[model samples]
Target: HNKRVAIDLTLPEHLPVLYADFKQLRQVLYNCFANSEEVMSDGGKITICAQELAGERLELRLTDTGPGVADDDLKLIFKKFFTTKKKGIGLGLPVCRQIVRAHNGSITLKNNPGGGASIILRLPLRPLITIGHGRRTNRAA
Candidate 1:
């Protein structure tokens, strides 16, 4: 498919540093960008935006100019082995969710009002803290 697609990736001058595995986080981003490209097979623009949310969280949202996801399928997108694409194994989103969870982050999806879908991922800026045995443990730094 020789479809012409335009990508607009925007990052601010400053961002909150998040603690996450480089490879896993890269994979998640690749999956999202690739999915947007696939959905806009004919040709469309994919806009990726990043911002710093409250509580020092990082928010990244990818919105594509393509057909949006069905309401019924929205909830299942993150489920293991679920997908709407004919050739997709459906493991991409699931793995993304798993990796995000491991980093104490969250991934969500929604349909854009005009058209296409939006994938939102939030990552914590600081390492997670847990208390066990009367001791505070930092998961990652």
Candidate 2:
């Protein structure tokens, strides 16, 4: 992309996070951003957002101003070895789905209202909790 292409990111405050391989998560997010950039071709805007949800959950969203995906292909977008790209291995989305699922999270893709694609991820804010003495405690929600 070019400098004209805007990428916005937002994250929620006071959110708890589950134990996960951050490296893998970063790779997945990178792949998704790269895909969006490629689809834009000339250049477009990309936005990334995150929020804390009820029940110790987190939500992450990435949206792009590129051509949106076909309605029929939305379901198969995460299937392994399935791709519409001219020179793609077809494993990016699938791998991302697998990684998210492994962390008890979910990944979804949809078309933006204005025209573009959006990928949403839902994750847990705290995978495990330890209870015992000598540990700092916080009020329960």
- Candidate achieving the largest TM-score: 1
lDDT string for model 2 (77-106, tens) is 999999989999799999999998877789
Give the poorly placed runs of model 1, Cα more than 4 Å off: 1-3, 129-141
Model 2 — TM-score against the truth?
0.84
lDDT of 1 by residue, 36-119 (tens): 888787899988999998756899999999898999999899998898999989999999999988877899999989989999
lDDT of 2 at 32: 88
* CA lDDT for candidate 2: 0.83
Q: How accurate is candidate 1 locally (lDDT)?
A: 0.87
Off by over 4 Å in 2: 1-4, 128-141
TM-score for all predictions? 0.87, 0.84
